[model samples]
Target: MDTRDLARIDLNLLLSLQVLLEEGSVSRAADRLNITQPAMSKTLLRLRDVFADPLFTRSGRGIQPTPRANELRGELQELLGGIDRLVKGEAFSPADYDGEITLALSEYIGVALLPPLIQRLHDLAPRLSIRTITRIENQLEQLAQGNLDFAIQIAQTTYPPAYRWQTLGSSPPAILVREGHPLTEGEVSWDRLASYPLIRLYISDLDHLEIARSSEAFIRARSPQQGSLETSHLLTALEVLRSTDYFLPGPAYLVRNEQATRGIAALPVPEGASYELQYRLVAHERTAHSALHNWLWEQILDTLRGLRVRTIHRG
Candidate 1:
């Protein structure tokens, strides 16, 4: 039925039905709802007519809901709860939100960020479930279509204004190699790096990702297909970096976690090869006035704000 059909429904009747279901006695239901028993009986008749089911049947001593009422019991409570929220508007506490949000980000960032992010959110909004996916066909488009709630991506130069974003931090280049690799022993340069293979960051859905390194400086290739080994899992990438001579190119802080990278090391980008990236928290403009969306965005921004990505100056 159209929403316009809802105008015919007296919302009070649903409340009465709920009370009746809970009380199981007409007199008790009426007393609980502050109405006369006859009035309550009449309301129950109206509800019956509306639902086309004798919502309750006489049991041995009292009353019991029919199969239809039994079904509507759960659905009706949900419907009434929605109505309550709608009437109350956006004044809500995070602890009250029982919704889920899907976030997209490269696993490289997720490794360093997700633990704290999830912990903070769970502390503040225990009822909120955050689901993360590492690969997506397109980040912004997914936010626009409501398929994704938020994304932590390498910043781009400009957005169409239909999207909202926050610059989380810088993501300067970090070349990851196993502890015993030759690059770790000698001066690490792009020329010396050429001897061993590079492990490219693989987010298979994106053909290329353009990263806005900084306000004035720009880098040509952010998502260049540069490596022989392409894997999206951070742990897997770290394992490969531990076992092989191949190097992984990524945000510096990703490999800086000592516990996670016991046998891996971060090399500053060579002077001539330096490029930078900034992490941006992106959401669609559709969520502009959504208190919940904004609240979650703020939580995310707070969770990932202080990454001090180091940079090397080039002549």
Candidate 2:
């Protein structure tokens, strides 16, 4: 806390602490830092003195961080990272930057957005590698901890203060049936829809649908059971619809191009029905200032906007 305490702290020691806290083994930490075991032990002793806490203690084969150490671990990584960035003092150039960017997005967005996004990256940042993962639990926590560069999913509620979200577009749910289906030729009404078996594509990644809640309630009241065919896979729902009288009620634009030829055509929802979902791009507050990240974010928004325009024209 004092100048003398600050003078005793070394950046290298801080990094060593990060590795030690992560690895929980002095030898392993030393190997990671490419330092001798004795040197690592000495650095740990210095870190203990500087922090005035026994940072780690023996726990079976490996060491466990104390409560104080556990608390310091998070702050230490961020602190060391900022210091490292400050020391490098290099501008971010997307074309020349060669690092892997991890993104967390759902299978739905992966199908709709990945192709265009990856193509854009290839054109602009040839050296940049993208690794996409499915949206997992504790998504915001993962994003804030730098596990994900960006997440493409539906945000049903407000995110924590540390996360930033950008609305892409909202798509009202539509009834998808075969090209020559009765609903396609007639006035599609909730009464008519309830007369046939429904194919529901359940998006497990969503906590709950923003606009689909009423639709869900109405369906439950009508059927009081799961859809005749229920699945999380969009293709599966479409496939079932292609072969059966089952009608799919989900995102309006899910069926496109080649799949549209699979006897798939969208039917407008009945009057006063509010089944829709708003997709958005969520990122950590820390990434907002990075030029490369911001550019990528803008490209995503632009791609989604174009898709919305095309959908509107087609509608």
Candidate 3:
């Protein structure tokens, strides 16, 4: 049979045919379908004309399905099953979604930012699982190959042609220090900041160079013993600063969250010494519009907007 001819077939007839084949009697089939016996008999007549087969033959008490009907039964059931799945959406429940969705995020962003969103996802979809990989490594390739669903990163000057991005929010970088740090007592001048050992939370390779370029005057004034300590991970840098005199420069919004303990305080980075970091949600252009993918995209934006509004209200 021509495949296109199959496309013209009425799907409701196929369902009725399946019911008749299973029941082996028009009255029984009508009972199963909640239709009148005469209506089911008319449907069976139509099915016979469409397939040019006497699908069932009268026996003593019940009808017996013809060989052709028996042969088509399994195939019809399979086709209907596929259609049901397609219409109902994926079998992923929020609580039992076992399929893995990989995301690319910096250690700092993941630690300081993603906790609440993760909790919300768990509450909404108990089974949906998430795996976060480092954002700075092979991000475009990972996204292109379908290994990653989305990425959260500080916006940069350029991105690969294959990917697209949406800005979440932007915030001025602030100095994070211990509560009783000497700089917090009064105005923190370049010389005063230079005296303390700086702990750098470096997310990308370019951050180090950018900080040096922006803070050249302070770097020149600091003594050799007051050099900076570098860590590839943001959370580690924050933990280090919490214990010792080391200072960290990071986004003020991230530090304002519940993660920041009473022991730490955010201070303004003095004039000409501040940097702007933009939070961005990124994904491959190809899959950006998919239902689940777009849902996640909006969630990130909503969360960022709520946080920004709350900050404004507090100030």
Candidate 4:
């Protein structure tokens, strides 16, 4: 039916149609719906008028469904089932869910968080699927549109009123280099680091113009390291480091585990460096009230706690 026809249809007619098709007898359907036989007959007549088809006909003392009525039965059953669930006001149970949850994660947070998060999901909700997106051009917009359930990243810019975020942890920058790189063995001085070309990982959602101005200032006052290969992907930067003497400075938690796995190591930042970064767990205001999202967010916080502890130990 067209939208206007659908708008004219009554919701009670759908329920009555479901009961009539299941029972196959007008009298019995009325009993099931706690209404009189005449009232149920009136509803069936209204259904036939709306559908422009005789939905049921005589079959001895019972009723026989017309082909059109049979055609609508399966679709009506599913629609009513959704309505039932919505009205039930039931608490979400992960074990019972068999749907996919989508979230956005930047490269570093994905590396640090996905392994443990996937493991936990497997243990608790094996059938539930998780789809993570890394190439997000607009995180908050995606979240508000229900395309993302959660996102973990550094909030360098102010968020709009529709977002709810929690700080994961904050740390100063650390330099990452290949295992046998010269900077790893010697005293890592700003001048020594500046002597080699650097791989710059571009994160932080702050305006790019502001980042450029700040970067220029840092280069002038601190070191004249040319950001030879700048990218949003940390793994790409790490791959560049494997064959060359280039190193990148970033938050420790994002690189610590990847460093050990890839034969890379961290060098202490110069003692006077003042740059600090903080990661946050972000969700849309719409999803912040969801029990399932809240549960997952709490697990993320717990994971970050362990990350911070291990980073201290590694230092």
* CA-only RMSD, every prediction: 9.2, 14.3, 7.2, 5.8
Error of 3 at 267 (Å): 2.7
Tell me the spans in candidate 1 whose CA falls farther than 4 Å from its real position.
1-90, 204-208, 211-227, 306-315
Report the lDDT tens digits of candidate 1 across residue range 1-315: 698878879999999998888899998998998889899989989999999999998887678999999999998899989989888786868988999999999887887788888889889999999889887877778889999988888766567879978888775777788887888777776566666766667653333445423211212322243446667788887888888888777777665677888888888766655666767888999988888998888877766553333222210
TM-score of each: 0.66, 0.63, 0.67, 0.66
Q: Candidate 2: lDDT of 39?
A: 92
Regions more than 4 Å wrong, model 4? 2-82, 88-91, 184-189, 208-227, 258-263, 289-291, 306-315
Estimate the overall C-alpha local distance difference test score of candidate 3.
Answer: 0.75
The candidates, ranked best first by lDDT, are 1, 4, 2, 3
lDDT of each: 0.77, 0.77, 0.75, 0.77
Clashing pairs in 4: none
List model 2 lDDT by residue over 139-222, tens digit each.
Answer: 677788988888877765667788889888777777788878888877987677777787755553445435546556446634
Q: What tens digits encode model 4's per-residue C-alpha lDDT throughout 161-211?
A: 878889777766678888899887779876787777777676544452223
Task: Give the alpha carbon lDDT tens digit for every residue of 183-268 in model 3.
Answer: 78888777778779887555543442334455455456566878788777766776787788877776776566656544778888
Deviation in angstroms for 97 in model 3?
Answer: 3.5
| Candidate 4 residue-wise lDDT at 33 | 98
For each candidate, how many residue pairs have backbone atoms clashing (under 3 Å)? Answer: 0, 0, 8, 0
Better of 2 and 4 by TM-score: 4
